[model samples]
Target: MPYRISRLGLVEIRSLDLDRDLDYYLNVLGLQLTAREGKTAYLKGWDERHAYSFALTESDRAGMVRMAFRTVDPEDLDYYEKRLKDFGIKYDIIPEDYRRGRALRFTAPSGHTVELYNEMDYTGNVLPTVNPGPWPEGLRGIAPPRLDHTLVTAPEPGKAIEFFQTVLEFRLSEMLVAPDGTIIAAWLWQRPAPHDLAIVPGKPGGFHHAAFVVDSADALFRAADILAMHKARIDYGPGRHGITRGTTIYFFDPSGNRLETFGGYTAYQMDPDSRAIRWTQDQIGPAVFYYSQELNETFLSVYT
Candidate 1:
């Protein structure tokens, strides 16, 4: 059987300071703010069914525990539910909401909560918000039409990889492991946009930075300059990663969750059943370091 994932729908991150965080994502990042409720807000970078790439929920603690992707339609949701049942996996369905739109939630084998939503409630008068000023000139913006991927950390890395492959129908495109087999990392995707999600073994239930693709290397540098100019701390490299073949830079938004911008990544197109490929240590560096020089020790210490 074939399974298709259309797009990353909405990422929910818990936040306590909604005003400051939302300002950074909307005004600075240039995502168009669409709608607002009491503590929840929606913003989007490109034209889509809904208002945003990420939805912020106010809380004392902040972190992402749920990720939603879009299935083709109601029938597609049924097909996915059936696929989960075939493997004896458990899930929950969320009907339409004034808040989340429409979606179903299930736990991936690695016990990551995943949701699939179809419709984004629309209002007739949707327009791109005022240009939040020029996005640091020469800086490539997340050029991909939409938000593409998120990297998640799982304490039980091996089981997580199995769950994504068996229950969610994601195929592994590449794998990186330490020589001792203690820390394992694998990249998996449903479509050709490189890995939509990557599994890294670490603190369970924690999210690594979500990645957005840039239009050009110039955008990447401009983004770096803008970030530095704004005094936003840089967390990781402007260096290239051999494994993903992308130039990556990491920083925390005013919100504190790590965010990454990349210029290039290898795209994978293969049957879900294709054999998984592995990368040696030399190919991918010692580890996927989250904190780079642009980010200072103080910021790095907080996440650790």
Candidate 2:
């Protein structure tokens, strides 16, 4: 049975120091701190049940490594778990840490850990506290409807991509491979909103970035202006990506985790049989009026 995932619920990451990184997400990036327990912190972009985003203990080894999503129903979760057992896939049931209400944890085929929560723990909707436009030059928040997707570093992109398709029922909206058919990068989508997850070549078990879908092009620029003031240097963006057809801006957090604010993504809700895609160096380069430099050393090293 194919798992019917409704939408991305929240991302749970292990941070070395909760206060230091959580400070950037709350005070700098403008995510509302909905709740906190010991070393764990739950954050919110907009109001929902509990928190849709959070960070837990583990600041010493900094990297985004976990994500959580909402299932269409409890039956879907059971269907997925049973299918994993039938196919010989192993998973775990992690209890709600201070933030997650009731969640089950497991590792994806690519070796990335993910959590599935049936509901958000809180009662009220936690919306963005910062008014994006009113802020000075560098400090701004990404005004998105909710959490978008995540980029993960996978040792075997093929295995990872396959797991999402075979196990999670994610469709491949776009794929890029080398001459030998080694999957370099993949963009998968569950609904019309661009990609729900991205696969990049890396050592298994770490996150690349988590993206937020902004409402408009104006929000993209406003986000950049605010980030610039806060000294959150731009990794790339304020332009269109050839794959998702979305205008995006990439930057790093105080902890060096990547984050993107995007708009104008082509909806894939219509065509179920979309073709695969590959991009050339020129396609993703500065010639398209986008800039790049030695400054992108970190992003390029992991992605390219």
Q: Highest TM-score: which candidate? A: 2
Candidate 1 lDDT by residue in tens digits, 150-201? 8777768888887877777787777886677543778887765557788876
lDDT of 2 by residue, 1-304 (tens): 3337767776766665677777677665677667687766767665344555545454566676577777777777777777778878777876566644566678886776787666555455532445543323432265454577888888787888888878777887777666666667788876555578888778777677777766576777888887887788678877666567666778877656678776644333425566566654434443222334223456646421
Clashes (N, CA, C under 3 Å) per candidate: 8, 18
What does the lDDT come to for candidate 1? 0.66
Residue runs of model 1 more than 4 Å from their true location after superposition: 47-49, 99-102, 109-111, 121-145, 178-183, 265-275, 281-304
TM-score of 1: 0.81
